[model samples]
Target: MLVPLTRQSFEQLIPVIATSSQYAYYWGKFPDFLKRLLISVVAVVVILLLKFLLGDGFDPLLFLLGIIAGLYWFWSPVYWASRRNIEIRRYKYSGFWQGRVLDVFVTEELIGTEENVNNRGELVIVENRERRLNVEVGDESGFTTLLQVPLRRTHKGIVPGQIAQMVVMSNQPDLSRIANKSDIYIPRLNIWVSDYPYVQRTVFSQVSRQLTQAEEDDYPANRVVKTRRRRR
Candidate 1:
């Protein structure tokens, strides 16, 4: 038997059925406040300089040239430098995992239980969560690194032996092959150090250490600093 619907029943269900939409917008840009400031400063300075030199003449050509000079002085370098530093740089993607960081030291060789394998031959191990990073030299000048990251929580989402996606910037396509277990380098995910989670620093330091030891100590002029995203 169907029970008849009533107004009181519909009213009681309305509040529970309504869902508020929440929007999270990442990487929003601010209005160019500095651009306005640059325009104002250039207008004032050019007017004053022309008043001293041209003595209040109705010269539109001189005014245009002065505007161009102001733009070059104030905004051109800022715009170009920001563009080269941010838009042109390449970035790697680190994996998302449901586990806490386990800071472990990396070394030439270590003993741990087999964890899992990704499509590449990288090895996963059930080792100490409190581990230290170690960089080791591998075949053909290949590099190996150990990273220690804190595990914030425990979850079954990432089993004891599972390979997760992690990305690193590499210029050589050959380096991409190293993530496999058969390769010399192994990659891990969800690792954090000094409260900053990620492997970029550890990876760079390890590479630098290996390079220095190999007597190839030279800093590239165009090294880009890896920055962490600000948490809301």
Candidate 2:
């Protein structure tokens, strides 16, 4: 079950967060059951090819073993590593969520289950607090409301409790105008996102300088004062 948290809550959990590259790789690219089935077929084909080319006398048992070995090597390592990594770093370990707050506001909520194009969907029950709430959620993905993220991967810094003050759109009267939200887990073969709003652009402005490990010298304290005097 998904639990909610605040930015401060997430910050407290960052220290223990797992930073495994192997986990990140798969968690960031988890596949579905159908895809796993396809992979098994490919594995069998590969085993057959190896036996035909190298096995002077094809041993059916050996070929079967090779297929099994291939599947084992492919699935277990990727799946378990990713799952373990996330588990090690999750709130269960740290006991809270951590992240920034971008903005919070309330609109009519659309609560219902949605269907996926390829697979069955879940029953999403959203309770649009009867009273409009200035909900503070992470807006890194332009998703003000709940988003169905993938199991293996997580959109970094887009954790719950982040805030976004600026808005490109406003709440609808009936909430029926809400566009269908995308399931982040749905894999796309050739997904090409166009004109999408990236966090770097929206999160920071040209006038703002990002911080680095090495601290840079601060701007002269009198700089602003001097500028103000000059304007006068």
Q: Quick one: RMSD of model 2?
A: 19.3
Choose the strongest candidate by TM-score: 2
- TM per candidate comes to 0.23, 0.26
Writing each residue's lDDT as its tens digit, candidate 2 over 1-232 gives: 1223243443332322233444344434446545656667777777777778877576877566776855753565465654543443332211111112333233433344544453356554443322222223332334444332122212222322322221111133332233322112101111111111111222222211222111223312111111011110
lDDT score for candidate 2 against the true structure: 0.33
Clash number by candidate, in order: 26, 16
Query: How many clashes would you count in candidate 2?
Result: 16
Per-residue lDDT of 1-232 in model 1, one digit per residue for the tens?
A: 0112233322222222111210001111234446645675777687768768876574676677666655653444444434432321232211111111122223222334558776798876655324233212222223333333332342112222222222223333433433311101222323222222112334433433432332222322222322222222
Regions of model 2 farther than 4 Å from truth? 1-31, 56-65, 69-232
Instruction: Note the Cα lDDT for every prediction shown.
Output: 0.32, 0.33
On the 0 to 100 scale, the lDDT of residue 78 in model 1 is 46
